[model samples]
Target: MAYVTPAPLTEKSTRTDALTPLGLLTVLLGAALSSIDFFIVNVALPSMGRDLRASPATLEMVVAGYAVAYAVLLVLGGRLGDTYGRGKLFRWGVAAFGLTSLACGLAPGAWWLVGARVAQGAASALMLPQVLATIHATTRGERRAKAVALYGSVSGLGVVLGQVLGGVLVAADLAGTGWRMAFLVNVPVAVAALLCAVRAVPDSRAERPRRGDIGGTLLLGAALTALLLPLSEGRATGWPLWSVLLLAAAPLFAWAFAAVERRAENTGGSPLLPPSLLREPGVRRGLVLGLPIFIGFSGWMFVSAVTLQQGLGYGALKAGLTLVPMGLAQFAASILAPGVAARFGGRAMGVAALVHASGLVILALTALWVPWSSLGPLALAPGLAVCGLGQGVELALYYRIVLAAVPAARAGAGSGLAATVQQSCLAVGVATVGSLFLALAAGPGMREAFAIVLGVQVVGLLGLAALSLRLPRRLA
Candidate 1:
């Protein structure tokens, strides 16, 4: 790997940036893989469950394990990339992700896949944090803004695309590979990006680097897992006594972890998460909104996939294709988001949230109105499209809103916290919303239960809408 520190792009340097496009592609492609991993597994889960004779608990573990591992390691991942060179770490993470994906695809049993997926999540954390940091370190002004917009779209779009792609891959069976095709598909794309980086991607490192906090890192990881695991796995397991005990202990562990971090900072080491970032108003508000958004979104995906396939008898490919319109709408909206934000302020977040809620409402109405056979893309198109467009616009805005309030010195900490909040919510979504859907489905058929759960999500979306009203529309 090359030791190329990021230089700001300028008129003179732009022409010399032969690797710029390649570098950007490599980064984007790597990011897309992580995004896909999150949603793509949805369609694949039932098949995996059948193949492994797994209970619902195992299926939840498969998803939660990856999310928990990824969330726990994310701050450390970003810090490691900063301490080491971005390019070197990014390349290693990408390569490891490829290996882990292969391991997941070829898994002999459910537990094995769960373990591999956790590793895959860790590799993703290492790579994803660097994607934005690299864009930030290397580009400026309009270029930076554009790159950030794309990053935002890709991040959300990944979930949508993953749903459809997983459906297709699992349904197609891809030479009897079945669910493995979903994971295996990442291999070729990763190889191509690996080649691109060899010639194009530049290296970058942290300025005013701080010592890594091993104690803080471990404590933070433990605290996050301790909180998330009980939530994600407990509902499925009927809230066993141990789950209750784990829930009780989460706060104590978190408090102890924070104290350890403060002590570490006093000793001249960088805690994986800085206490100061938490005190920043905008970043804190962003987390408040982000938590519910991700929780609702992830929970919706888990429930919908099950509803569409097992309940409605749609194939995987069909389930995946259902989200295509939303993905397209999102991509279109994200491209236009910055200009809109510039004119209207952060008001876009609230409006987008309303649009998203409307989309859910529309879909819910369609489900209620149409019989099962009549409900397809047409029924979901308008709401899903609105949701997608609004989501893309706000997601981009969230990045700016969160970071706008922080100093450059605190970028990694700020970004890491943002990611942690989002990921934690996603896990909670699976635990709460997803579990609720399944619980209800046992009494009704899948379709009705799904409708009921989505109705609740509409409430969550409206809450986001209300929160957005609190944002001062005159945004940066």
Candidate 2:
């Protein structure tokens, strides 16, 4: 279990090593695994429900538990990599993810599956940030730009692919594992990634590694958990006292976390998330713009799965396959993103947001007019493709601008901060937007509820459009 320590980096070294193709592939796999698992369980939920005899609430936990664990630990995971070595942390995380996936696959009951999912999420937190941090620390110029674009593509595709792959795996039911294959599939992928990472991913860490920020990390995690847990589970559990209390406690923990971060700065110690990073104009503005884009995206995915399966009576495989247009459009747009960014500069975010909003409107209209029994993949394809295109381009541009502002010396922490925003917003999207849909559907028809939720998300996208205008016109 001993890991090789990477040699110390000089302060002035602009780049550490040339990123090999194998290294890029290895890191992208880690990113894919982290993101795919988030949504993959969606299509498999019905199967899991029947197989395990789980209630509606427990099925929600199957998704929320993993997201909460992953989102909370992300900042600490990034810091650990900065202090120890990104390559070392990446290896450990991938290995742990494999083991946790096996645990999930073999789970004997609903609660055991939930526990294993939480552990899988923690492992993802350890592995994912290092992907961006490594690219930032090691690559330069066109190479860095290309790498970032590919990262965006893989990320967007991961969400789409999760749905597709989940449907395939569950339908195929390899070895008669049924829905269990959704979790089990990660085992072999993780093993291959770990081996490639050891040889290809260069070892990199912060130039001045410092002591961990235990207090700030805990406080920040507490705040996020307080906020997300209630929203994710409150409706299903009928708004219990604990859920209400947790929601009320969120703001206090957030305030305390901010204070602790400032104190660490005054004492000349490294905080898990450095406050200075947010002070940069591009970094600050980019995070704001990126937040709503991801929130709406994840929310749409969650609601779509439910609407397709429960509301419209589609099979899991059909529901998953219905997103094919979205996946294909996103893949194409992501590859074209770097060139588009080069041409449009920062205005690309505004453009992408507009495109995204337009797509959402189209989707809302489609859902409103089409009868539930009459709707099919063709009815949803146009809007899904448009949304995917905008999402792909904006995601790439946001990642480029947000991290480009950070000093390489703080790459790991900066990467963590950016990813924390991304992951946390994703969880919030499901908790708030997804929960709102579910709550409404209970009272009204599913079609009516979905249209209303899509309208709300359109407003969120409009907000993103406005925020995008404030970012710097170009990344450094």
Candidate 3:
């Protein structure tokens, strides 16, 4: 099979010859915030509901709105980054995110909070693609590998940290801010990142920047919004007629978007997503595997939150603390990922998947056999640790495989698409798996529902393992 090497990175019109440590950390902060915000709000939901007097459906909006907006705008964000400067866009995104977080922190009502969260998601979309794109453009060989590994590790850690930090912030209620602290916390972090980014992060853009395709962008956004909005909000909204109509229109919009993109590509215009990029075997196959992995990852967080807090009668802090072991394991695995991948090739992901599945099985059995009242965080520690480690490894390897194949010029688009798939799957996972647990819990009991969901995820993990076989044995 013939493969094309991506265009080499264009020389930065800046003083720095390479991305500095602070530069990398600043970008990683953007990546971390994007992933963290997705799960962080989960632990803060109860507190938000109580403080705002929000209905169940309104509460769901606070979460789904962000995911929907983020998924819809990500590809465009990438295009904009390629056209504009990555450093410029990233700094603006970080600043915007901080302001939005402040808005969220100060929101006096549920609807206000939802609006702020949507804006925050938009900022995230702009910021996050640049991280991967910047790394891909500026770094090479072992440095690139290490950077990507850390990126993946941070992605996993962000999810875990969200729960822990959200729990802590709400529990602390510093200055009587209560739940508002969760969003408010981002203000300082974003400030720090922005300051470092200006000095350290090199400004880089596509060698051949293309004009944005308005038709393709609109159609793509319409397609994603139609598909994701309904899935994320339908359960809460009782699957209304609008949801059905949107769902029905989703495929049409998607097909139209693809057609528009293909036309744009053939006409020498840069489509929002260049159709040719999808032709890469690595990108296509890695995306396919990523869908299920993200689904399981987000679904596990959602289910665990409900089970630990609502089902097991644990406090928010205790529930958060329970996952500490898993987070540690995830951190360790991520740190070790580059070496492991070098040794084991793509099969490392398969091994990781098996370990993840085994952990899920253990968790399910613990839920099934142990009495609900008797089950404690410690009881689930071992399984959670193993699952986290697998997740870290899987994430690191998969990211390396997918992005390693992308050309430098198209890095923004590739990274955006990857993040889009990842976030979309996360929203879907929360909706489907969470809905399943809620429905079953309404009758069969929470313990049974919990086990059943974990069992379902175990099957998905094994499927991911199978999918890993198709990835290139070694990255480029």
Off by over 4 Å in 2: 1-17, 439-444
Per-residue alpha-carbon lDDT of model 1 for 267-331, expressed as tens digits? 77677777766777787777888866788888877887777777777777887788788899999
Q: What clash pairs does model 3 have?
A: none
- Model 3 is weakest, by summed lDDT over 10 consecutive residues, at 1-10
lDDT-wise, the better of 2 and 3 is 3
For model 3, residues 54-161, the per-residue Cα lDDT tens digits are 999899899888988899999889888888878789999999999999999999899999999999999999999999888877777777778888998898899989
TM-score of candidate 2 to 2 decimals: 0.94
CA lDDT scores, all candidates in order: 0.78, 0.85, 0.87
Native-to-model Cα distance after best TM-score fit, residue 396 in candidate 1, in Å: 1.4
- For this target, which candidate reaches the highest lDDT against the unseen true structure? 3
Candidate structures ordered by lDDT, highest first: 3, 2, 1
RMSD of each candidate? 4.1, 4.0, 1.8
How high is each candidate's TM-score?
A: 0.91, 0.94, 0.96
Backbone clashes counted, model 1: 5
Q: Please give the lDDT score for candidate 3.
A: 0.87
